[model samples]
Target: MKFLKIGDRNLLYPIIQGGMGVGISLSSLAAHVAGNGGMGIISTAQIGFREDDFYKNPIVANLRAIKTELQKARDLAAKVFENSKLTAKFLDILKNYTPFIGFNIMVATNKYADYVIEAVKAGADIIISGAGLPIELPELVEKGMAVSGNEKRTCIAPIVSSRKSAKVILKMWDRKYKTTADAVVIEGPLAGGHLGFSYDELNELGADTMTSRNYKKDKYDAEIKEIIEEVRIYEEKFGKKIPVFVAGGIYTKEDIAHVMDLGADGVQMGTRFVTTYECDAPDDYKQTYIDAKEEDIVITKSPVGMPGRAIRNDFMDRLKSGPIPIRHCHNCLALSVCDRKTIPYCITDALCSAANSDESHALLFCGSNAYRADKLEHVEDIMLELTEDMN
Candidate 1:
């Protein structure tokens, strides 16, 4: 595959492991992917769920975990280079390589700006924000840079699903910050977790069915083209190339080639990575994806006020009957969007349950091709398979 250039770093393969939440993609997964030459990302959503004081002081715990996780990922990547049995080619790749470690912080989270600042201060190479339009991301990033006093400017990227969202974010950043995005991740309808598209739009796009593959190629390709064209306008104004990566429903080497041929600089995949041995999720969680069927994948409502794709389970079935009683608020999402009194259920609890391997009542988020996984694999092997056919 072609190298994915972001600022000064050239990722060996134009592939990014999409960040999964609540305990899924952490130090282990991120480190392995980065070591293998892909941009590895850790999800900062309730990252400290295992901490003793998480429920009592969620913000403090998460902020502390941010530093810990990033350090752990770097350390893990370093250990790979220390191995005595490394191949000559692997040794060559490590000779001058610095693992590209990043964090995915949702814009809808409570204290969104705080999380951004914490991630930057903790020395994240890049921060990818989504779950809402990151309108003030540039401002937050600048603030973080100032607070950290770090020599290297932390790169920022916003996740957008359509040309309109892309245009709005880029124009706002240009007008306000006199800058454009370092990169852009275009997430489509078939993505896991909280999707940007409306429920109606996703339904019309046929995001959940086997036919969605054809839909992505024939119909979604137009949307991808439009967004790339919009980004090109800002690229010219800023006099730099802003790489665009496409996420959702990207499973194989062919998927990577198709999106690249359609103008995407790279591909971001989440579901396929969950089955990797190095992924932070429990074995049961990974098995959920392996055991899932085409019919088991469904779209459900999220407390973040967006539609999410997940595997159908007892939890989802119960939600269909009525609003589940929320025992306590984790205060995870912004109060403006997720009011404790009005929301259906506590998203933090559900996702945390999934992370802890309580699959019966957990929110099992997965991409459209989640059912395609049949066995656990290694990150290095998966990375090779995805880029073997590319130049």
Candidate 2:
């Protein structure tokens, strides 16, 4: 496999382990991917809650969790830092083992602006933000983080739904931000969690009307190709080869081969990593993916004003029948455009429950192929499987 570079640093494997939230891909998995020659990304979405004190203040839960997760990532990184096994004495030496440590910060999350800054301080090399138009990302990346006691390059990678989104950011960067994008991710309908489609567009695409859940189709959809084509147009206009990565429903080596054949620089996987040994999600969470049936994975609408794909379970069945439960509201009022009361369940409760392995009420975000996951394997083995026969 060919190594890829982010500015001056080198990543031995262009492969990027997708960031999963609420304790899915934690330091263990991220460190392993980086250790095994790939770009490992730690999702900063709910990082801090791993701490015992994460939930004392209900409103600042995400903030507390971010702090906890960053520390946990460092703690779990002990093995990767061992002198007997490729030790990284300086913080920058961490670049060699897992050079491209990234953070997936959702623009939709509460306190998102502050969260982005925290990721940089935690030594994130790439900041990939999605769930909405992250117009302020360039400004965040420019804030800079310290490594080797000096400011390091922080790459901002935005997830785009269409060419229009790509063009808008590029124009904004050129005209207003005075910065060019370091990279971008083209996420499709098959991805886990949120989508970029509209009500009518999704309806025409066969989305269920009463509920916001999505379904699976046998063949590749045309919308994804359109998104990729749009991304390419922006790459051409920018006059810079901004690395384009793709995600969603990537299940096997054949799937990886196909995307590579289509000209994507790399692929990102969230569901696949969830089953790996290093994944920080609870064993039951991992088991859910292992034992799931093909038809069990479904999409649902989040009170957070987003359409998400997840496993069909009792929690959702309960949502449609009764008044949506609300034990507490963070009221962080993170997004100016969002209405906080519209949020159904405290994402904090449901996700943390699932992370703790209580599947009865936890919100499970999964890709269409999550049910097709037959076994749990090491992250490196999956990497070997995908790249073994690569040309």
- The ten-residue window of minimal lDDT in model 2 covers 81-90
Candidate 1 Cα errors over 4 Å, as ranges: 81-94, 208-216
C-alpha lDDT of residue 225 in model 1: 97
Mind giving the per-residue lDDT tens digits that candidate 1 earns over 135-172? 89888878898999987878888999999999999999
Clashes of each: 0, 9
* Model 2, span 203-288: residue lDDT tens: 66564332223443322345446556666665677665667777876778777767766777777888888888788888889998
Q: Which numbered prediction scores highest in TM-score against the true structure?
A: 1
Tell me how far the alpha carbon of residue 323 in candidate 2 is from the true structure, in angstroms, after superposition.
Answer: 2.4
In terms of lDDT, model 1 sits at 0.86
Whole-model Cα lDDT per candidate? Answer: 0.86, 0.69
